[model samples]
Target: MNQVIELIQSHRSIRKYKDTPLTNEQVETIIQSAQMASSSNHMQAYSVIGVTDPNVKKRLAILAGNQVYVERCPLFLVWCADLHRLKVACSLQDTEMVAGTTENFIVATVDTALAAQNAAIAAESMGLGIVYIGGIRNNPKEVAKLLHLPELVYPVFGMCVGMPDHDPGQRPRLPLELIYHENRYDPEKAKKGIEEYDQMMRRYYLNRTHHSRDTTWSKEMAAIMRQPNRKHLRSFLEGQGFRLE
Candidate 1:
């Protein structure tokens, strides 16, 4: 495979990091690469907050379900889906801005995710390790308070990046046959593939090093579905001034 494809396939969520810190130049380079990502209608409705303060990171770690990596990682980046800037633009043009629409919120969230993926790829290319921290959403309100976020802006997720202290195998993905469709939806074929993949994942989980779990993909998903996961997100978004209409 080509270098680009190989790099993409080598992705792993690295949790442990070395004590070394990334230089400002390297951080800026990754941010610049993220800036190159496509934005919906060229709105660029997103921003990133790089936290280097140990005290703040420690607080964030507690807020993010006691994930120590947030505090220990050399650099922690909080990706925010922002519509406030568009409001500012509308004000400058003497026009009323409709920032509460669900479409705008969706667009801003997508833009933030795409930009973060770009930054992740850039960081990996530079021999750094990174992991996306969705736990940041567990306490979105408090996180916003800690970060001093204004209305029409919210943290979708955070990322921890630093030198690798350990190497982890990439998690397995569902088969291409199950995920990829030709012309239309093929539920039967997808179901068959998933049945076989469930067994495959059963073996994977049992064989994985350290903290091996006795579960299959379907079983794990079922368990997760049975539990409430960020069900308050809609209310939190509403509190942030997103009408989500």
Candidate 2:
């Protein structure tokens, strides 16, 4: 296999990191790789804040469901979907930029995610470990305030980067047959594979972690979806000047 292909296959999220800090050159290389990602319409509508302040990282870790990795990691980056730049450009031209719509918001978010993923892959190639902190969305309002994000911009997610203290076992993914369908679709075939994959997940958890119960993937999915986990997002997006209508 190609080196990149091997890297892609072996990639695992690393939540526990060593205390060693990254050099400025390493950080710059990661950001440069992130900026190289292709953006929608060439409008690179995103920004990344490299946070090294212990106080700021501490608050962010708390806001993100008390994830200690955020504060422990030597480098913390908050990736944002930024439309404020376009808005400013429009203002200078004496024209209005109506990017609070759902389409615009989605585009910016996709752009941000692509860039972040590129950065992750690039860092992994450099023998560094990284993990994405989606829990940052748990308190988007507080995260925005902490990062000083302007209107039309929001924190999509966070990344913790550093050397790995321990390499976690590979987390199982769904069988490719279930996820990759032919031209039309095959729901029945996919459903059968899901059961096997759920068992694989259960075994992985039982062997690796303290999770003793045979928690099927379906059960976990239902629990999170049925709960009011993101009920705040609708109103929160509105508060951030996004009109998702």
Clashing residue pairs for model 1: none
- What is residue 181's positional error in candidate 1, in angstroms? 0.5
- Residue 194 of model 2 has an lDDT of 81
lDDT of 2 by residue, 1-245 (tens): 99999999999999898889999999999999999999999899999999989999999999999999999999999999999998998899999999768899999999999999999999999999999999999999989988888888899999999999987888888888887888978888866888888888888878886776768787788898886776798787888888886
lDDT of 1 by residue, 108-190 (tens): 99999999999999999999989999999999999999999999999999999999999887788999888888999888896
Per-model TM values vs. the true structure: 0.97, 0.96
Looking at candidate 2, the ten consecutive residues that score lowest on lDDT are 209-218
Q: Which stretches of candidate 2 lie over 4 Å from their true place?
A: none
Model 1 lDDT, residue 243, Cα: 94
Local distance difference test scores for all models: 0.93, 0.91
